[model samples]
Target: GAGVSQTPSNKVTEKGKYVELRCDPISGHTALYWYRQSLGQGPEFLIYFQGTGAADDSGLPNDRFFAVRPEGSVSTLKIQRTERGDSAVYLCASSLSGLLADTQYFGPGTRLTVL
Candidate 1:
């Protein structure tokens, strides 16, 4: 089975621009999540979708960040007015179960470099 994957493994963008990162989850997985990891820090949860609806989106830093999982499979993280502080690795994960205890398989990530 195909595991989760992300695009643009590396992205360089100017400050105040917009960017979009994509994620493809594993087959048959119903739970998907997005997280961001800054240098020397653990991944911080951003948003999660169980099926087509966002189950938890509390971790999204501000209005500039948003995500969507329309078909309950692939998801995209869109950032508007990107800033230098937004430079980080955006990771995506999926799990067989939607519960917190379920193990999430992670994607390589899209490393955004906002200059």
Candidate 2:
């Protein structure tokens, strides 16, 4: 009955570098999502997966960002060419379905700091 969890809670990276942030979803949940939250802003959906396929990825900003959920349970967000603007809380959430109204339980997030 573990809830969604993210590692490293904080990360500091140099510009133009690459980073990977991980997420572990709740048991038995087949839906997982990744979102980025900037200061004082709402979480912007990045990608969502149902089972092993990415059901929605339109929210990803550009090619520099990517995510995967190979096992349908744990997910990882990868960023290439890190920029100062990419510094934010990378949150992970999970729900029972990919439906619009499903309540997503979020993790504390890995705060990526770009220097």
1-115, model 2: which lDDT tens digit per residue?
6788999799999999999999999887789999999999999999999999999999999999999988788999999999999999999999987688998999889999999
Off by over 4 Å in 1: none
What's the count of clashing pairs in each model shown?
A: 0, 0
Relative to the unseen true structure, what is the C-alpha lDDT of residue 56 in candidate 2, on a scale of 0 to 100? 91
Per-candidate TM-scores read: 0.97, 0.96
Model 2 clash pairs? none
The TM-score obtained by model 1 is: 0.97
Total backbone collisions, model 1: 0
Report the lDDT of model 1 for residue 90: 99
Clashing pairs in 1: none
Model 1 C-alpha lDDT per residue in residues 1-115, reported as the tens digit of each score:
7789999899999999999999999998999999999999999999999999999999999999999998989999999999999999999999986987999999999999999
After superposing all C-alphas onto the true structure, candidate 2 shows an RMSD in angstroms of 0.9
lDDT of each: 0.96, 0.93
